[model samples]
Target: MTILLYDLVGRDTARPFSPHCWKAAMALAHKGLDISTVPTRFLEVPTVEGGVSKLVPVIRDGEKVVADSFAIALYLDEAYPERPTLFSGDGGKAMARFIERWSQLTIHPYVTTAAIMDLHAMQDEANAAYFRQNREQRFGKRLEEVMAARDAGLGAFRASLEPLRSTLAYQPFIGGQSPLFADYIVFGALQWARIASPFRLLDDSDVVAQWFERCLDLHDGLGRKVAAAAAAAA
Candidate 1:
């Protein structure tokens, strides 16, 4: 049976942009599992799968229901031992934990700022209102004001990726020759940026950007299935 993934989207349901949801999607692909996605929006999250969790990236497999990207990944690895392993082993699991935190801290904030307004634009009226109000309160400023700082934040964001860039210089993927859950953890962040905004997050010359291109080609261009926001508009 194909697992059902509750993937978060905006007005364009074809584009699933949530980083967490991307992680789950990539994990499903990595495990070689057949899956279908239910396009969910911000307002619909509460009602997904009978309100399983406050957040999305929910998956229903057979009689089982799982939420959260990391939890879903763990479930897939355990349930389908015959399939490709997401973490590979206990050591890989620990490494994935670290990478997840690093990506959240070092990458997410900048991407959030850069893409916030565009993301809001992608929402329907009701969702846009909710997004603007909630985010303004969270940042204690208007969305435009928050986005203004993204230009300044870009340098820091690029510099912060030095560790990842250096690692990629030596290996094709964070998982060595092939991608593991660790790769997906970081890939999810960039994929979120790619889908949400037209602003170029990385320079063409940067190894990180090159690595991202390769990732987009994975699983028969799974990431490429959803065009970058700019490309979609063009």
Candidate 2:
């Protein structure tokens, strides 16, 4: 059965570098799994008839509809056990869960906020159109209200980054040498944020930046591909 991944075109989600979807995509790519990507815009209702709420990064493996990124990762793990293991052992499993949760609960908001602010700055017309359409589809409220909420959300996001900064300062990866789900989760969020906002989150931190580069190298040379493509386009 072919693995079908529902993704966003040009990374339109809250974070431009969606670590959640990236984690799933990276896992599949790392395993060299035969997969097809179906890019969709944010909040676009899925054509599949199911009970799932509207969300991007849904995976369809034959008749099965796997929603949510973490759930999709679990499904991939179960379906293809021969690939590099995500959870090495009980301790590793625990760390994986913690990292996933931390990325979602803490890192996601600030990164997303930064991205939105960046978009507004760089592409005001396109960003405003996107914001209007997305707010109407997802929030079903006036644009003003959505903007207000986004402001509050950004503040909350800044507060959330404090713990992550402290934690990352100590360890090279979330686990140490080898990166597990934690490293990927954090990387994904930060990657998306950097792509969208071009922020300096890792600029001053040598260890974290090096670790991030190492992770990219391990995962099929994504950074290389990006650089090559940019150079070619230039």
Candidate 3:
């Protein structure tokens, strides 16, 4: 059966910009599962799954409803045990949880500031206002104010990527020979930036850059299918 994925989308429905959503999307692709994606906006999230879920990346497999990106990934892994594994083994599964947390707590903050403007510009008025209000409340400043110093945040962002860069310098993928769910966790964050903003998060020479490119080429150029919007153009 084709699973129903309520994916978070932007003004352009084709663009699914949520990092969490990307993790689930890529995980599904990795498992070679057939998915029917519904492009869902922020305001519409509450209506998903009969209003039981207030988040995107909610998936319905038959009568079973799963919410949260990570939960969905775990569900996919268990639901399709015969397919390719999202986590290689128990250790990888536990490690993936740590990596996911680090990406969310450490990396997302920097990305938020850098891509805030580009994200807002791409949104319609309602989404733009909703995003601005929530984000501003969290950051205690305006969206423009947060993104205005993106250049200033570049150093920190690059520094935040050091662990990934160092690791990729020696290995082809985070899981050594192949990308596991852990790899998708990190890739999703970068993909989030790519879809929402043109701000270059990695330097041209960084190994992380090369790793990210390899990730983009995965699953028949699925990542390349989305057009990246330039942050300056907004």
Against the unseen true structure, what C-alpha lDDT does each candidate score?
0.93, 0.61, 0.87
Candidate 2 lDDT at 116 equals 53
- On a 0 to 100 scale, what is the lDDT of residue 62 in model 2? 82
- Rank the candidate models, highest lDDT first: 1, 3, 2
Residue-level lDDT tens digits of model 3 in 88-195: 888988988999898898778888888888888778889988988988999899888888878987897888878888888788999889888888888888899999
Candidate 3 residue pairs that clash: none
Q: Between 1 and 3, whose lDDT is larger?
A: 1
After superposition, the stretches of candidate 1 with alpha carbons farther than 4 Å from their true spots are: 231-234
Query: CA lDDT of 160 in candidate 1?
Result: 96
Task: Please identify which of the two predictions, 1 or 2, would achieve the higher lDDT against the true structure.
Answer: 1
Off by over 4 Å in 3: 231-234
Give the lDDT of residue 147 in candidate 2. 43
Clashes of 3: 0
Worst lDDT window (10 residues) for model 1? 225-234
For candidate 2, write residues 1-234 as lDDT tens digits. Answer: 578877554443332334566777766665567777775554343553353646667778888888777677677777778886666666876668887887777876555544555534333355457656764577566544444545456545655665655666777667665666566677777666555554444444445566668777865685344421111123
Q: Write the per-residue lDDT of candidate 1 for residues 1-234, one digit (tens) a residue.
A: 999999999989899999999999999999988999999999999999899899999999999999999999999999999998888899999889999999999999999899999999999999899899989999999999999999998898899999999998899999888999999999999999999988999999999999999989999999999998874443
